[model samples]
Target: MQLLSVNLAAPHAADYTDSAGRVTGIDKRPVPHPVLVTAPGPKGTGGSGLAGDTIGDPRHHGGDDQAVYAFAREDLDAWAAELGRELPNGVFGENLTTSGFDVNSALVGERWRVGDAEDGPLLEVSCGRIPCRTFAGWLGERGWIRRFTQRAAPGAYLRVVEPGEVRAGDRVTVVSRPEHEVTVAFWFRAVTTEPELLGRMLAAGDALPEESRERALRRGA
Candidate 1:
C-alpha cells in the first residue's frame, strides 16, 4: 500500500481530561518522521506497568509509532475532500497516515516493511485498535471508538524491527502473516466479547506476543 501521510508528536503541553477532571500531559505534536517512541512515563524511556498490553493499559501515552492510519486507495480522494485538506492532521491524532492497504485484515502478529526494494525499511508490528476515550478524544467524536472498531480498520501498533527513516509516499509491504486466520478485528472481538479466544490465541503460539499470551491466560483463567 502507498503511504498517504506521515505524522509525529514531539512534547507539547495539552489538557488531558478524565474522571479526575483535566490533567495536562504532553499535547500531541507533529513529528517529521513516521516513527515515534513514547514510554509509560514521561520521556521516551521506561516500561509501562501494564502487562501484555499493546497500545493502552497506561504503559504508552501514544505508544510506538503511535499514529499510523491506513486507508484504501479508492477512498483516498474522498477522504481528502472530507478533511478539507489534502490530508487530515488530527483525524486520529496520529503520527502517520496511509492509504491503499486493507489495514483491517492485518492480524495481531503481522509484520510490515516500509520503503522500496532498493532503499526500504522493515518494521514488524502488532495489531491493536485504539482504545475508547483516548481514541475518542483524538477523533473529537464521542462515538469514534465504537465506530472505528465497527469499521474494523483498527490501524496498527508498530515496533521498530530495524530502526530507519520513513516518510510519506513510502511503500508498505506485508512480509508475513500470522499462522491462524485471526485478524485484528477478530482479536478485538476475542478480547472484548469472547474472552475464550484469548486462550486459543495463546495456544496457537507464535501467532501472538509473549505479553499477549500472558494477558490471555489471565483472562481465560
Candidate 2:
C-alpha cells in the first residue's frame, strides 16, 4: 500500500453544532512536503503527531493512542459513489489518505512501516475512530452519524511507534500482524451497535486502547 496524501489542519472556528463547536481542526488539507510524525504527548493534550495538525477538543481528540488517523482511498471512493459527491483526500479529517489498503480489515495491534526503510515511521494500529457530531456537522448529511455507524467502516487510529517524516507517495508495509480476529470494522460495529460483540473485542488484548479495552471488559463481564 502507499500513502496517497499527508493532510494537516490548524485550529479554526467552525459552525459545527456540537459542544460549542468553536475550535475544530477537522478540515484537513493535503500538504506537499513531508511532515514529522511523533507522539503528541498524552491523551488530553489536544494536539496531533502531525507537525501542522491540531486537535480542537482534547476531551475527545488527540492522544498517544490516536496520534495518527488513516483512511483508505477505496473507502472514500465508495462513500463518494454512494453520496454522489467528490470526497477529497482530506475531506474526512484523516491525516493519511491511503491507496491500496484495506484499513478497515486491518487487525488491531497491526504494525505498519510507513515510508522507506532508509527513512520511515513505525505505526501501530490502536483502534477505530469513533464518529461524533462534529463529523455530521462537517458533512451536513442528513442522518450522517447514523449512516456512518451503520456502514461500520470508520477508519483506524494509530499510535506512532517510530517517529519520522512521512510524505505523499511513501510506501506502507505491514511489518507485523497480531493474531487476533478483531478487525477495525469489527471493533467499530461492536462498540457502536453490537453490544454482544464487545466481549469479543477483549480477545485483541493490549492491542486495544486502555479505555476501549476497559469498556470491552466491562461489557463482557
Candidate 3:
C-alpha cells in the first residue's frame, strides 16, 4: 500500500458545528511536503497529530486514538461515482489518503510502518471514523450519516505508535496484525447498528478507543 497524500485541514465555517469561535476543520487539503506525525496527548486536550492540521472541535475529535484519520482513494472514487461529483483526496477530512489499501478491512491493533526509512512512523489501526453532524454538513449530502453508515466503509483512525516524518508516496507496510477478527468495518457495525455484535468486539481488545471498549464491555457484562 502507498500513502497517496498527506492532508491537513482548511478551516471553514459551518452552522451544524460548534459556533463558539470554532469553525469546522472538515475541509482538508493535501500537503506537498513531508509532515511530522505524533500523538496529540489525549482526546479532548489536543487536536490533530499532524504538525499543522486544525481540529475545530476538540470535545469530540482528535487525541491519540483518533489522531490520524485515513481513507482509501478507492473508497473516495466509489463515493464520487455514487454521488456523481468529484471528491478530492482530503474531501473527507482524512489526514492520509491511501491507495491500494483496504482501510476498512484492517483489523484493529494492526500496525503499519510507513516510509522508506527503518525509523519511519509506525501507526496502529485504532478504530473506524464515526460520522457526525459536522461531517454531514460539510458534505452537504442528504442523509450522509445514514448513507455512510450503511455503506460500512467508514475508513480508519490510527494512533502514532512511533513518531517520524511521513510524506506522500511513502510505502505503507503492515508491520503486525493482531490475532483477532475484528476489522474496522465490523467494529463500526457492532457499535452503531448491531448491538448484538458488541459482544464480539471484545476480541479486538484495547486497540479500540476506550469509550468503545468500555461500551462493549458494559454490553458484554
Candidate 4:
C-alpha cells in the first residue's frame, strides 16, 4: 500500500454543530510535501501529531492513541458512488489518505512501517474512528452518524511508534500483524451496536486504547 496524500488542517470556524457548538480544524486539505509525524503526548494535552495540522477540540480529538487518522481511497470511492458525489481524500478529516490498504480490516496492534526504508516511521493501529455529531454536521448528511456507524468501516486511528516524516506516495508496509482476530471493524461494531462483542474486544488487550478497553471491561462485567 502507499500513501496517496498527507493532509493537515488549519484552525477555521466550522459551520457545524458540536458539543462546543462551534467546531474548527475538521476541514483538512492535502499537502504536496512531506509532513513530520510525532506523538502528541497524550489526550487533551497536545494537538495533532502532524506538525502543521490543528486540532480544534482536544477533548475528543488529538491524543497518543489517535495521533494519526487514516482512511482508504477505496472506501472514499465507495462513499462517492453511494452518495452520487465526489469524496476527496482528507474530506473526512483524516491525516493520511491511503490507497491499496484495507484499513478497516486492520487489527488493533498491527504495526505498519510507513515510508521507504526500515528507519521510516512506525505506526500501530490503535482503534476505529467513532462517528459523532460533528462528523455528521460536517458531512451535512441526514442520519450520517448512524449511517457511518452502521456501515462499520469507520477507518482507523494510529499511534506513532517511531516518529518520522511521511509524504504523499510514501510506501506503507505492514510490518507486523497481531495474532488476535479483533479487527478495527469488529471493535467498532462491538462498541457501537453489539454489546455482546464487548468482551471479545478484550482479546486485543493493550492494543486497544485504555479508555476503550476499560469501557469494554466494564460492560462485560
- Which digits, one per residue and each the tens of the lDDT, describe model 3 over residues 181-211? 8999999999888889998999988788899
Relative to the unseen true structure, what is the C-alpha lDDT of residue 104 in candidate 2, on a scale of 0 to 100?
Answer: 95
Provide TM-scores for the models: 0.67, 0.96, 0.97, 0.96
The candidate 1 region of ten consecutive residues with least summed lDDT is: 48-57
Clashes per model (N, Cα, C within 3 A): 6, 0, 0, 0
User: What's the CA error at residue 144 for candidate 2, in Å?
Assistant: 0.1
Candidate 3's error at 57, in angstroms? 0.6
What Cα-based lDDT does every candidate model obtain?
Answer: 0.51, 0.89, 0.92, 0.89
Candidate 4 lDDT, 1-221, residue by residue in tens: 99999999855666674535475777889999889889998898987888999888888888899999999999999999999898888999999999998999999999999986555689999999998776887888888988898899999999998999999999999989989889999999988889789998999998999998999989877
lDDT of 3: 0.92
Q: What are the per-residue Cα lDDT tens digits for candidate 1 across 1-221?
A: 86665543332222433422333222223344544322233313433212212222234443443323333443434545654555344245444456766665776667777776444555545555545664456446546566555555555655555545566677888998767766766666666656677766664365454556678889877
lDDT rank, highest first?
3, 2, 4, 1
Model 2 has a clash total of 0
Assess candidate 3 and give its TM-score to the true structure. Answer: 0.97
